[model samples]
Target chain A: MSRVVVDVVLKPEISDPQGQAVLGALGRLGHDSIRSVRQGKHFVLEVDGTPDEAELKQIAETLLANPVIEDVELHLTKD
Target chain B: MRIGVLTFPGSLDDVDAARAVRLAGGAPVPLWHGDHDLKDVDAVVLPGGFSYGDYLRAGAIAARSPLMQDVVTAARQGLPVLGICNGFQVLCEAGLLPGALTRNSHLHFRNRDQVLQVERADTAWTADYAAGQRIVIPVKNGEGRYVGSPADLDRLEGENRVVFRYVDGNPNGSSRDIAGVASENGRVVGLMPHPEHAVEDLTGPSTDGLGFFTSILKAVVNA
Candidate 1:
């Protein structure tokens, strides 16, 4: 068995209000040195056998993230 | 004329869209997201609401539905299509329109009556209104802000594809105060405001939204 992890984040140019809110909360909690916070999504997929990088990339690009505004990264592991 | 209103699993505004069509003197056909058929309707309307409970993204899942495949194909061929609110997000996700609607810069769900200046009156859905006319409609959403690369935005402006621009004040911090946009051929339009909710004077902020439905009827007749 193999496991695939996909991480999706809004492109740097796109504003993330949720992440900004989190940063605000952190500031209120006295984490003054942190300059930025950007929110994203994480997905874990379990496959029956070995995971292919190209197929996983296709999945991430087609469904996991929108290329127009978001970037995606994938990591695979054997189980 | 017959106009189709799509209903996804969590769509909340399909009924309202149909009512708007009826009020505008067009027959409204109900379409299902799970179906591949478009029922040969004259035009299509993707209504608002949190489809698939807005999983992944606001309109991500719904954009990949069976019906949307047909919609994307038909839209490219110059079919008149209107997308409202969540439907607007779906249009962007489906690549029928440009730019993506993101969370409001203020990070809040905003609901209000917004004034918009009509920039292009030639689109299938905005032909009833004169250029530069201002209309009031209901704007409601958390992820309604529009974002795009600077060059793409410049290109859209160069092509005069921006259909509506928010006046009075920008509600969700949309770039250039854009409230709506049209496809290159002006057959497809997507906006974050609920024009369907504004078709009736009794229930809406104004009856201005009836023009959207009426415009499409005229577009079909003239086509």
Candidate 2:
């Protein structure tokens, strides 16, 4: 079996209010050293055998992430 | 005229959209997201809701549904389409319109009576209103802020494709205060406001939203 992992993050230019809110909370908690925080999504897929990188890329690009406002990175590993 | 109102699994305002169509003197045809047929309707409306539980992103899953493929094809052929709130998110996801609706900058679910200025009344969805007309409509969303690259936004403004702009104050921190935008041909329009809810004076903040439904009727006639 194989596992495919995908990370989706907003584009650099796009604003991440959730991350901002978290950063604010962190600052309030005395974590002022953290200059920034950006929130994103992580997904894991378990495949029967060897995971196809191209197909996973298509899934990440088409459904898992929006190209207009997001960037996706995929990693595969043997289960 | 027969107007099609698409109902996705989590669509919350399909009924109200249909009611708006009926009030505008058009037959409202209910369309399902899983179905492939459009029922030969003259226009289509993607209503607001948290489709697919907004899993990957708002409007991401629903935009790839079977019905949206047909909607995209028909919309490209000059069929009039209106997307309200989450529907507007779907439109952007489907690539029918430019830019993306993002999370509100304030990190809150804002629901309020928003005033919008009609920037371009030439689109199929805004023909009933004259340019510079201000209308109050209810906007309810957590991720309704519109964002795009500077160059694309400049092009959109230069082409006069921005259909509506926030007038009194920006509601969700949309870039350039853009509340709605139209396709190049002026057939497809997506706005982050609940016009369907404001169609009737008895329930809505104002009846200004009726113009969106009524404008399609005139657009069909003129086409």
Candidate 3:
């Protein structure tokens, strides 16, 4: 079995109130170097075998992330 | 006709949806999220609530439930389906409708009586009103701001898929004041407002939302 990690993120143009709130908290904690912070979803999928990148991209685009408001990044990770 | 109202874990409006269906002269069928069957309902209603406890994202978890697969199939086949509040979020997550409902830009959960204008009256759930007709209904949600791709919004506008538009101020920072939207075929509708909460005068709000339920009954009969 192979493991694939999918990272889903909101587009830059979309307003992320939750992320902004997190940034506010970070500022309160004295993280001066970070100007902005965006939140995203991460999913690890157990695949049948070593699936090709196309298959992973297809799964991310079609099911894991909504293309209307988010983008996706797929990578293979080891156990 | 029998209208199916699906109840997911944490659902708060299934009973109200079923009541509205019965009031609209249709038999109300209770459907469950884990069930794969729809029981041959004439229409389906995804009622409001914090499904999956709004985990991951609002309605994101419940949208992928087994019952939603059947609802998606029926919706594609032109079954009248209404998604209210959290259900609207589920519809977008399920890809049965375009656009996504993000957290309100104001960073607050808004609950109030809202007025909306009917953008298109030909849809399965809006035929009871005239185009541009305004009605007051209850609007409530934390993540009700509607966001969509620019090109897709243009396409929806060009094709008249924008079913309901906010008449007053934008309640949740939704683009173009969009309160609700319909599928291109007009059989599926997703709105952030709690129409089921305003179906009757006894509930306090105007009975304008009853039109949504009645329209679906009429559509099923005509079909």
Candidate 4:
């Protein structure tokens, strides 16, 4: 079996309110060293066989992430 | 004419949507998320509320529900579809509309009356209103900000697909001050505000929202 991991984040130009709130909270909690925080979604998919990158990309673009405001990176997390 | 109102498990405004349809002199057909058929309704409404408990992102799961397949097909075939709030998220996720509704820029769940201008009066949902007509309706949601690619935003603006625009000032900081949008063919519309909630003067800030229902009724009758 193969596993696919996808990380979806707001496009660099788009504003992320949740991520900003988290950054603010982190600063309040004294995690000042972290200069920036952009929250995103992570998903792991276990497939019956090695999944093709093109197919996975299709899934990521069409379902896992909204292309209008998000960018996704897909990786084979495990084999 | 009959209007279909899909009621997912967490749908909070299906009844209200149905009520609006009835008030506008159309039969309200109840549709379920588990079902695949559209029940032959003249038009369909994906009402507001936290469907699928808003799990895995608001409207994410509901957009992939079985019924959406039929909804998408019908919408493409020129059947009128209106999505409100969470319904708007579902539409965006299902690729029925442009843009994603992200968290409000103010990082708050805004719930209040909002003024909007009818930017495109030719859509299936806003035809009753003239272009630039101002209307007040309830806007309520945690994730209501609209975001899209710059090219897409420009294209939408150039094509006049922005059916509604925030008046006075932007409410949730949506791109281009957009409050709602219509499909290229003007057969589908998705908006963050709750028009169904403002259909009655006794229960809401104004009855301005009745135009949405009446517009659909006119479309169905004219068709």
Candidate 5:
């Protein structure tokens, strides 16, 4: 099985309202970098078959991330 | 005509986009974001959704998808590609079209039926529309504001590339109330509104949005 890790991050200067909302909530909780946070999702996919790293990277580029709003990092691990 | 709708991992509207293409009398081809092949589709539609879960920016990461490389090549070769909402975000990230879509100044997720004026009927996806004709379509997004440098905006205006403009109100604070635009070749078009949802009369405020799909068919046939 092949496993892939995808990291998504927002662009600089683009205000993340969702992150701001969380920051506000966190401040109320007394957890303070918490000045603001940009919200993003991370995915770990385990493919059943052997797909080359190149093939997997293709999927990450086209399907997993949109370059305008998010940047993605792909890491492959063999178990 | 064969239409390809790219499905990114977080893409929300691939099914709806495929349905819109089929309803418009074209074959809908489901293309994976990872695959480099376009599957011999004549046209492509980048549907709305929070691709990559709107992770890095919105459409930023998805613009670099393996399939998008092929998309960029095909688009340059004259294949018509339409980007709606987040898809519009992807197109700009890919540099397939000019300008960028930013967050609304109001900083909220805005959703509503928006009226737009068809500003450029000469484009491939807008041939069925008449200049200045008002059409209603759904606009929904948080980072939906359209932005560009003043010089570029002037150039777009001078070059007549502005395809659509908000008619009644600017929902996302888009510059010059711009809602949609097309590439110089007219083969690549992107808009902040959701035209796919408005194609069916039963689900749509009006059937005017179907004209965008039909316009591409006609453009493909005539080309």
Candidate 6:
């Protein structure tokens, strides 16, 4: 089995409704100075079979990430 | 069947999310973000809302929630996982799906009923619709545009992974006018619109969103 690390990042300057809502709630509670906010996900996986970069790429495009709103990186993690 | 809807500290739509699941003829289980268990639900939904207050990023924080460990595991095991809006952000952040949600090109929050073309209907969450069907659903979000490198976008298009695309106008300036996507396994799906809010005619803008819920049900039953 091979271990892989995947990281996804959202594009910059997108309005984050969740973040804005938090800032709004915080401001209502008297906290301030929040300039900006964003969100993303990171994943580690262990898969069986011969490690193939092509298969990994397929995973990234199909299930691992949305090409439209996100960018993803897949790295081989030495076990 | 039981469907789990995860709720993080900042989640805004857990109740509505659970309601949608119930409306679709499944039991809705509220899974806590800090818990690492999925309650063995048949399917999972990462509902839209400000999880972790969108701190660090829209889904960056919630992606690391304790419950996500199980979500990732179940998804890898071929369980159906659907992420909507903020949930879509979490899926990308959790590395359960590809692509990323970015700020709208206009840098403004958009909320309206948007029309979308179903590009792929083979996923566990989208099997009920035809490939070329157009549906309307509620889409309210701050960071919703989908972006990727030109080459990467081409790969997605070439592979038929682009599941949903905007029909009338690009809502958030997503490249290729993409609206949603699914995993190659057809077990997982993620989208920018709020399908849960469109299940009923009286409450939802149109009944088009019901197909999403029904699609998953059919996929699960068939599997």
Candidate with the greatest DockQ versus the true structure: 1
Order by lDDT, highest first: 1, 2, 4, 3, 5, 6
Candidate number with the higher DockQ (1 or 4): 1
lDDT of 6: 0.81
The sequence of per-residue lDDT tens digits that candidate 2 reaches over residues B58-149 is 99899999999999999999999999999999999999999999999898899999999999899998899999999999999999999998
Candidate 5 per-residue C-alpha lDDT over B21-40 given as tens digits, one digit per residue, 9 for 90 to 100: 88889989999999878999
Cα displacement (Å) at residue B40, model 3:
1.9
Worst 10 residues of 3 chain B by lDDT: B195-204
State which docking tier applies to candidate 2.
high
> Candidate 5: misplaced stretches above 4 Å?
A1-79
Candidate 1: regions farther than 4 A off: none
Candidate 2 runs further than 4 Å off: none
Which clashing pairs does model 1 show? none
Candidate 6 stretches with Cα past 4 Å from truth are A1-79
lDDT of 5 by residue, A1-79 (tens): 8787887665654456678777888999989747767887798989887757888777766566655445678877877
Candidate 3 lDDT over B1-223, as tens digits, reads 9999999999999999999888878899999999988999999999999999998778888988999988988788888899999999999999899989998988998989999999989989999999989999999899999998788889889988899999878889999999999998999999998777777788848989889889998999999
lDDT of 1 at B82: 98
Better of 2 and 4 by DockQ: 2
Predicted structure 5: lDDT: 0.85
DockQ of each: 0.88, 0.81, 0.65, 0.76, 0.12, 0.16
RMSD of each: 0.9, 1.1, 2.1, 1.5, 6.3, 10.0
Model 3 residue A50 CA deviation (Å) reads 4.2
Clashes of each: 0, 0, 0, 0, 24, 29
Error of 5 at B22 (Å): 1.2
Full ranking by DockQ:
1, 2, 4, 3, 6, 5
TM-score of chain A of 4: 0.92
